[model samples]
Target: MNDHVEKMKLNTKKFASIGIMGLLGLVVIFGSVYTVEEGHIGIVKRFNEAKSQVNPGLHFKVPFVDSVESIEVRTRKNEEKMSSSTKEQMPVTVHVSVNWTVDKSSALDLFRQYGGLTQFEQRILDPRFRSATKDVIPRFEAEQLIQDRATSIQLIENNLIEEMKSFPVVVDNIQIENIILPPKYIQSIETKQTEKNLAAAEEHKLERQRLEALREVNTADAKAQGIVKVAEAEANAIRLKGEAEAAAIAAKAKALKDNPLIVTLTEAQNWNGQLPQTVLGESGMPILDLRNKQN
Candidate 1:
């Protein structure tokens, strides 16, 4: 009995030691670790289930049952070009970028909901981008797409966000890095623009000419009116002066008619002064000497 008890005690002690060793090995295996990488966030999963979200630091999880998933928290970029969207059926190469991140506040929920971030991009971001570009660009002709690409980009962004609404992802912005139109197409557009500008300029010139003609007509009317008024004033002045002169002459004639004695003496003086020369009819011959005859 004593030997059996001692054997039992020894076995129990070895078992306890092994159990402790096993527990320690588990902690080492599942313990938290720090990453040297920047711009990354961590997610913890327990038994294939998301348990917690962690920042960029040392973290631990339940040994074998827990796992850490790292996601890039920083902005990442990729370039894409859609050729069928340019004007003139010309191929347009656009360098586009997608800015994205795992929604940190929803990280645990997201991981659990979507299983991982990788699925989010494949299921949400890429399709959103592709569908948005395809759906919106078709509304525009190739020329409008390339020529008015900024407006097109905005439309694409709005549509992309609308499409991603039911998704677990968020798009910060849809960037259009470059727009390449065929050289011929660009030249054609430029020519059209120049023609439009010329038309506008011609319209302005015509408007100015019309205004100037109107002004000239007004000026001519004004000058004619001025001349007419001046002529009428001069006519009135001359008539008034003539009336005054005629009144003066009538007064003088009346005075002379009333002074008959003075008129007769003057007639006698005039007859004596002029009758002899006409009657003699000398070498200075006169056909009539009417003053002497009247006297």
Candidate 2:
């Protein structure tokens, strides 16, 4: 009975050891196999040194001896606000956005150099972006920055791209979202614009008044010309009527001079059919007394 009890205790100890080993083996297998999701790349690091890079899907590494770091290889966006100055030394605030992506081929090298994405952005990308923005912004005046915002943004993007050429990341695009100017300057510009508009309006009003005055002058001239024409027409008509009357009088005078008996004929034609009561001669005596003969 004592030997059988000792044998049963030994078997129990073996079973426990086997179970523990199996659990450890299971843990190792699960730990060694890792899946890299879509749009991500895995970097295998052995003893804290970057060894290799793996693409998306299941990948194997030595358990407890090697570690995998997954990094997103897809496009990303980051926005930053920077305080800068214009060429005229006007202080301004700029909001900028950047679209960037990690190079999948350079993942291991990037990890070896910068450790991870967070460190990469903090140490390299952020500083470079700030530097590029500050460097390019001072080349433009405040008014130019506001009026030609697209040109200024393009310049900034170019400078940033040039600055980032040596880095492991790809800079897809850069956008300048907003440029904030001083309130007093903005107010002054608005006031100046208002004054300019008012001056233009005043000039337009003066031009309109001048045109109206010119039009009135033209109308007066035309009316005066019409009146002068009417007076000329009336004078011509009067002159023609006087000429006609003078011609008729002259023609009558000529006819009367051509024949002296015209007056007698005219008197005979006008005389009534009646004899005179008395006729007086040069001696003032009655030459013929028709009244006595009739009696």
Candidate 3:
């Protein structure tokens, strides 16, 4: 009985030693090393205080004394929707998107100042972005907000970037997703544009009528001028013909005055078998007595 009791006591001691060794092995295995993933940074903490930063890969730490906290340095995206008023007192809703990442060089300071990436974004970047949208949207009119949307977006982005200059967050891009205006305002704009188009059309019609009237007047004047030219030509032709006839009569009278015998010859050539009772000369005296018949 004494020997069996001693054997049981020795076996209990051996099992206790094995259990202690296993616990120590687990502690050494788990606490000695850490891994940093791709695109991540490991901040090593010794005794609850930050000591150093490690890049992606396998790294060793003091067993049971050191701890590592990882922060993603990869780019991240966040979106916000803002409501604002334009310069014209028009209400608008704007949707905005932001792409950002932790500045690698400023990561330690960032983690030290703020607890983590979430705290920095919540406390700094998001508020500034919202503030920038509110401030910039009011500077432009509603029409400008829609027509020059790209410009407005750029302005907002620039304001956001400037606001974040003192922070460690790197703002990669800011984009305007949508801008919605009131339906009544859109209808009013369309009505005004329609009125303007109608007025322009009326003005164009008047211009066309005026041009047509001018063309008619020009055509009438041209026809009148043609008629006047034809009448003048006819009058000139009549005057020339009268002048030619008068010249011929004058020439014949001069020839008759130069030779009276030509008239006697003309009379003899025209006489028939019957003779006239009297024949008068150029002096109004009887030249031939035909009262007595010639047997």
Candidate 4:
């Protein structure tokens, strides 16, 4: 009975030890396991020094010795209102937006240098963006800054990108939102624009009238040409008719010249086949002849 009781006691202690060991193992595993969410990068450090970086997923590390810091590698946005002077020494107020992200490849390096994302932005990004805006805004006149806003924004974005190339941050976008100018300058610009519009409208009107006048002149010239052509055609017809009548008269004269007996024949035909009732001598006295004939 004593031996069986001792065996039961030993088995109970063994099982209890095994259960305790399992629970400890579970605790260690749970503590070391970490899930890095999407758009975040994890830096693993052993003894407070960075050892390796893990991409977004489930990862495990040494429970107490290895530490992990997650840094967001996603794009972040910030806006700023900046005041600067243009090339002409006119003060301008501008609203700007900056989009940026921590380069994933340089995440560990960035963390080491800048400590955290918030620090990096507050200390480095903000100042550099402001500097870039100030530097680029002065290159253009105040009116150009307002009128050519796209160009101005591009210039600032390019400048900032170039300036930040040495850093571990990537500049995604820069937008110049609004520009405020002095009231007097704005009024002057408005006046000039109004005058320019009026001049353009007047020029367009004159050009339209000029084209209309040219069309009228062309129409008049066409009508005159048609009239001249008609007159020339009528004159040619009259000349041809006159020439035909003249030719007929000439032909008749030639026929008369060729045969003078035509006139005697014509005269005989007109005699109506009748002799004169009385024959008169040359002295205008009547003459009578008596003859007897047998037939």
For model 1, residues 1-295, the per-residue Cα lDDT tens digits are 9999999999999999999999898777757444424566677777766777788766656666777787775665544667555333446666676676556667677777666767867766776687777666657776666567788789888887788776555678777777676788779889999999999999999999999999999999999999999999999999999999999999878977999776778788778563354363567675555453553
The residue pairs that clash in candidate 3, if any, are none
Number of residue pairs clashing in candidate 3, backbone atoms closer than 3 angstroms, sequence gap of 3 or more or interchain? 0
Query: Which window of 10 residues has the lowest lDDT sum in candidate 4?
Result: 284-293
Residue lDDT tens for model 4, 1-295 = 9999999999999999999999999989997998899999998989989878899999988887888889999999989998988899998898999999988999999888887788888998889899999989999998788789888889889989998999988899999878888899999999999999999999999999999999999999999999999999999999999999999999989999999998898898898875665556888776744344579
Error of 3 at 87 (Å): 1.2
Mark the regions of model 4 whose C-alpha exceeds 4 Å error after superposition. 1-26, 255-295
TM-score of 1: 0.56
Clashing pairs in 1: 32-59, 32-60, 86-142, 87-142, 87-143
> Model 1, stretches more than 4 Å misplaced?
1-41, 46-49, 55-67, 72-78, 85-93, 98-101, 113-119, 201-215, 232-295
lDDT of each: 0.73, 0.90, 0.87, 0.90
Please provide, for model 3 over 1-295, each residue's C-alpha lDDT reduced to its tens digit, 9 standing for 90 to 100: 9999999999999999999999998889878977999988888888878877888999999997998888889999889988999998998898988898887777777877887888888998889889988988999998888778788888888998898888887889878888888999989878988999999999999999999999999999999999999999999999999999999999988988999988998888998968677778888786877676879
TM-score of each model, paired residue for residue:
0.56, 0.65, 0.63, 0.76
Q: In candidate 4, residue 114 scores what lDDT?
A: 82
Q: Which lDDT tens digits does candidate 2 get at residues 88-136?
A: 9999999998999998899888998889999999999988888888888
lDDT of candidate 3 at residue 73, scale 0 to 100: 90
Given candidate 3, what's the lDDT at residue 290? 63
- Quote the lDDT for 187 in model 4: 99
